[model samples]
Target: MLMNTPKSLPVKVCKIESDARNTAVWVKHIQNDFEIIWILEGTGLHTINGEQYSLSQNAVYVALPGDYHELLINPGAQGYIVRFDTSRPDQVDSDYHTINESWLYYYFSKTPVLRLDAGKHDKMKNLIMLMEQESAAYSSLHSEINSKCLQLFQLYLRQHIELLSNPSCTYKMNSLLKQYFWLVEKDFKTQKNVEYYARELNVSANYLNHMIKRASGYPASYHIRQRLFQEARKKAQYAGFSMKEIAYYLNFTDISHFSKFFKSMCGISFSEYKREELKRAV
Candidate 1:
């Protein structure tokens, strides 16, 4: 059964199982803060974002924050479901699944699932069952058990990325677009205008903007200013350097100019932004 968590949930490590020829519970459109499902016995089907994935007894399913998913199983399916909240910035034991949209678009363009080989599946099963037993029986060494659980969790992710990466996929790159992203991704916060990047990339500013928007769905200027803003965000704090020094480092001619630019972009003075971030961190 999937549960709704309106907040990011901090889950330690735990596993639950539904056995075939034993129990029947259909998992429907529920959002989880963090979920990892591993197939143990039979086969089943899962739908995430309306994409259906076939799952055998060795498949691992991952539901990141705010993901909509539903589960349907045949008569002879068995598996384990572990739900936890770890990506939240604060508080454990709280689940933040309020929305029904996925944040994975920033990174993962496809569904997040991993199917393991039989040998790896057996190893995962052992770790999951052991965590269940230790958590079920309280002992003075609870932290030790938790550490082991996190280790197993890491092992799962390592295996997942290894199998998911297709070396052949790199050949599919749109060269000009790839270069555009790399240029902006490597230098977004310090430069905020399209014309400058256009000069460096040797394209006219108009052409650069068009290609950037076409490729990344964001304006080239947006990427540049974003990069500059990122640097401003970092330097507005702890850089005992005077505002003038910060301005010059960012290639601004004068402190007043930098201040205005920062204010225009961030709606606040650099000092104010730094103070706010510090307050939040504290």
Candidate 2:
């Protein structure tokens, strides 16, 4: 059961479970805050942003504001859900603010879920259990402990990305890539050039491109273009803005440039893509 959290508190953590086999409740929930779901033991179907994924043990999902998610767990399934409002700068702790700049949060906007190995699973499980316990009791130190635990959780995820995600990636390369990705994410809209990001990362454009290409099988420019394309697709699919407005929203100089870029990246015109998506929806 989820705990009753005071509205004033910026962070809340609680345990979650599936109901009886015959009466399980699965409801679509909109993410209005930053949320993390850690499934300790569960076989379920998780629908996130209209895409369905199989939910298994040691699976973790991060949901940003505006994401649509729903979970249907089988009988006896258990998990933990943590919700924190980072929108309120003053209410959120400094540790959480640090996490906002972390690679885990940067990755969340792209890859929402990660499957943990046994050792990582146990470590996160213990941290989550401790958070649950702290959340259960109201104390003067409760908020501090919870904030510190959240920091540890972020550290673990960031460390996992560095140490486990790619075995061949060296520490220096991993650190550089993290900085590079973060920079691109921060400035992709206004600065779409790979040289700009390379400059910000303090590495030569060719070396940066080489390392990023080696790691992701795409050059640095590909990431920037992909990020812009992703935003364009999202706006086209969901927003009420027209192509011209979307072009302006993405800081494009003109509609024709936006259209050409869209066609090149998607292999279809913007209008054609939208029409196909509409037909599929219907």
lDDT at 211 for candidate 1? 69
Candidate 2, residues 1-282: lDDT per residue as tens digits?
Answer: 444455555678867766556424457666677788787775777776667777778878777665666766677778888777766667557446645543555567667887676777778878878877777776777777877787788777767666655755432246678777757656778998888887787889999999988876778888789778877776676535588988988899988999999999999999998887677557
Every model's TM-score: 0.47, 0.76
Query: Could you tell me which 10 consecutive residues in candidate 2 have the lowest summed lDDT?
Result: 164-173
Q: Cα lDDT of all candidates, in order?
A: 0.56, 0.73
lDDT of 2 at 62: 79
User: Total backbone clashes of model 1?
Assistant: 21
Tell me the spans in candidate 2 whose CA falls farther than 4 Å from its real position. Answer: 4-10, 21-34, 64-76, 84-102, 105-111, 136-144, 158-164, 170-174
Report the lDDT tens digits of candidate 1 across residue range 101-183: 11222123244676576666667777766665655554666435644564566455554554655533321225454555555
